[model samples]
Target chain A: MSRLFVAMGLVLLVGASLSIGVADLWAADIDAGLVMAVSRVPRTVAAVLAGAGLALAGVVVQLSVQNRLVEPSLTGTPEAAMLGLLGITLFAPGSALLVKMGVAAAAALVGTTGFFVLATRVPQRDPILLPLVGLIYGGILGAATLWLAWATDLVQYLGTWTSGEFSGVLRGRYEVLWLIAGLAGLLWLVADRITLLSLGESHARSLGLDYRATRLLGLVIVSLVVAAVVVTVGTLPFVGLVVPNIVSRLRGDNLRTNLPFIAGLGGALILAADVLGRVVRYPYEIPAGTVFSVFGAAAFLWLLNAPRRPAHG
Target chain B: MTFETCNLSITRDGVPVLEGIDLSLPPGGITAIIGPNGAGKSTLLHAMAGLLSPHAGAVRLNGRDLSGIQPGERARSLALLTQDQGVTARLTVADLIAFGRWPHHQGRPGHEDRAAVADAIETFDLGPLAARTLDALSGGQRQRAFVAMAYAQTTPWILLDEPLSALDPRYAHDIMRRLHDLSRTGPDARSVVIVVHDLGVTARFADRVIGLKDGKLFGAGETGDLMTSDWLTRLYDTPMEVAEVGGRKIPFAA
Candidate 1:
């Protein structure tokens, strides 16, 4: 099923790349459109990479927390990154993209660390409470970003950064997303330890696995991926939450086996969503994040309502 | 190899649960820890398995202090099946059993790990259910699958805490019988320690019995020596009698 989606995504991406050049729809020349599409290959690739990265980050967060509701956005990492981007734009106007990305990454790391500390401090009476705490944390950070954006009269800039669009993800602007691939590779290498830790702390310790170290490593990977994706393409909602749950349904919960499949499906899902956003509005384009929000929310509801299987490990 | 606890005490949240627990078990047979509710049987088992830390004294494996050893090394030496073990995701029977070899191979599983997994599947009669997901199995089957995972760990010492809780009589007997057979026939042999409520089954299947009353050791000896009416009465604080039926000891009371 994911393979079918990938093929469809590729076709849509190619079509959108061609449509970017043909100013007049009726008088479109096939050869000119092909040339334009070929030239924009790099940008399209960047978008795909960013989508895949964010999706993979989502997978890692969901698995680590053992809750489908968790994503980097839900945990306040993206909101924190947005605040950092806002800070850089306001204080150090005309800063390099690298500087902006660094600030965002640092903010994301601190936000993630804060989330973990809060989560650990709360007694484990109900698993559902962790994600609720995360949602509240993310909301607070988002409100802070909103206040900063309004104060600086850069609310438009913040809107573009948070809207989940691909129009600005061209050439040099999108290169930062490649870092997510590196994070994905790191996750694969530590997949075994991560899966063991998911069985709960006591069980992991009983197996002689270093639970705390493994959990910290997973959090770091999640932070890096979340920051990179946010800085590249803004905040894409529900892609991470939806893709991992779908992958786990088709594949088993073994992280080693599911990581690649999750990455592929995540990339494919995001690309397809991006393409649909372009066509749904015809000459104008809706942001992929908006499209994903509508679909991702429905998928989330389905997962929540689905009959829970006894083997929920 | 034997496990010994010397003056062991455990406190949770500054409340003492087990105090001055001194006990030893010789290698190679089934040992049952029989106790009334709240006698700290489960706490003792958890401490022995290194899942809980003792506030004072120590638990030793083959005379080496258990706390001094690393968790991985201890895991290789002992396998524990805690009461109410849970798996919160959809995992196949085979996948669940493969977790047993996590300590042996870490992340990279080899042929030996695969063989051990297969051996566990066959040993627990899970061959037919190997491909089935745990959500699809009956409670009895799921219980057996978990036991198989512990079996695949292949440690010399196996500790179970209330393994038969909520299990029907037939499934309970079946599990006990399997444990009994494994203790007797395994190549390296194994010492099985179980916390059980059914005194009749304990008297019939256990080679040795340790009885606890109100967080203290009431008796510890061979099953025959420990199954007297007076011992049973005092231990449970109820009128109790022991009778032989079909050449098997049965414990009963009003």
Candidate 2:
């Protein structure tokens, strides 16, 4: 399918999903402007930001690690963010939103760095080994979060983070996710430097690129992106993993050229998932994260079993 | 301009890979660094490119310390190609070659960059495979494209680490010939410092030779003076023979 047409379709779907909700939002009796301003617009914006951020994060992880199978969620960034959020929410319950986000982002940076270090140690690039290690690493972090939550009886608060559901998103609550847009812009600025990352450290250094600095910058961006998404609308599993893969397959790995398409497709996929969640159970919405997982897991399975293409590597 | 190493020493994991290395490599023709495995050949190349910082001493480019030069400036002066040029991303050969211009244009490629890329493709005979992804090509073809990338850098100095290590004699000789021509032809001729394994190619193509063994310089001089069987055997710690062929010398392990 043509990218332009697909893009147009996504924009249309986003528009349609906003106007057509469970409550007849456009009905004459209803305050359509208020409805759009308060609930619909915020939800749509949050979904797009979270999706785009995760997708960009995924590309960064894959590039920095030089492995396509890894993503921010797999690298324990989101789980670590959850732990940070849980701690802040329990201990400093009255903390400002920014404080909470800052704490979460710091934890995320540390966790992602840990994953990056671990990736370097396991030099066997067996394709599957790295991602599996990441999955296990993330699982351990997640278990820690779960155990801590259980001990503190704060497991209920963890609900919003485990699965992304934009139903709760409203005007002032979702503004922090705008930071993802800013971070994405930052990533676009350094896309070429980040692309050098996939070529390996020694090679990048040989090219006059500051290999350590660029890699650190990429990790910082990935951590902040994952933190913003997780703290806001919760963990949107596989959005990063799946969106960037599809975009790279369709386009290529030239980060500068493909950043927009990746952002667009990421936005489209999550918005579509949200729309599907809404319509699949009218008057009762499934979380966008849940909806995406079903599709994402299937796509991942297909990707794994698919006949390997010579041109891919 | 001349590239020189002055008492350079480098260590890896508390053990030295290169120690007290000093040599002057004059710009113009091919210079081959030949040694048995684990002789700090790659380490020396990396340090010259400033990819590795020495534990002590310095590398001077035209009498200026390499450490003092910025990485960006260093890159514009010389382009280094490593032995294992493994790329995970699905990049077309054109994209890969164009990346050589990253230091010059830095993402926003200009007409000159494009022209250099085209010239490199033509020079390396990669026109047929330009659009193809690196994974789609055979090992030799892929290597040719990699060499083209280093050429497209348009730097005055080119440092290649065993680019022809895995190729057949035909492919090896083919690359050597192109590199030989490149170093000799244009006004903006590039000086090449290659970590070469094939002794015959080195004797034929290299104007200067630097022999290394056990993290130290074994010998350094004009190719004629360095290619003797006595120096060659001592360098490798094995018997070697040099035979005259077509009015040129070819050394082989005996």
Worst 10-residue lDDT window, candidate 2 chain A: A304-313
In model 1, the clashing pairs are: A311-B89, A312-B88, A312-B89, A313-B87, A313-B88, A313-B89
- Best candidate per DockQ, number? 2
Taking chain A of model 2 alone, its TM-score versus the true chain A equals 0.96
State residue B191's C-alpha deviation in candidate 2, in Å: 0.5
User: What alpha-carbon RMSD in Å does predicted model 2 have with respect to the real structure?
Assistant: 1.8
Q: Candidate 2's residue-wise lDDT over A194-267, tens digit each?
A: 98898888788888999889999998998888888888888998988888888777766889888988888888
**Residue A152 in model 1: shift from native, Å?**
5.4
Give the runs in model 2 whose Cα sits over 4 Å from its true position: A307-313
TM-score for each of the candidates: 0.88, 0.96
lDDT of 1: 0.80
lDDT of 2: 0.89
Interface quality of candidate 1 as DockQ? 0.37
Question: Backbone clash tally for model 1?
Answer: 6
* Candidates' C-alpha lDDT: 0.80, 0.89
CAPRI verdict (incorrect, acceptable, medium, high) for model 1: acceptable
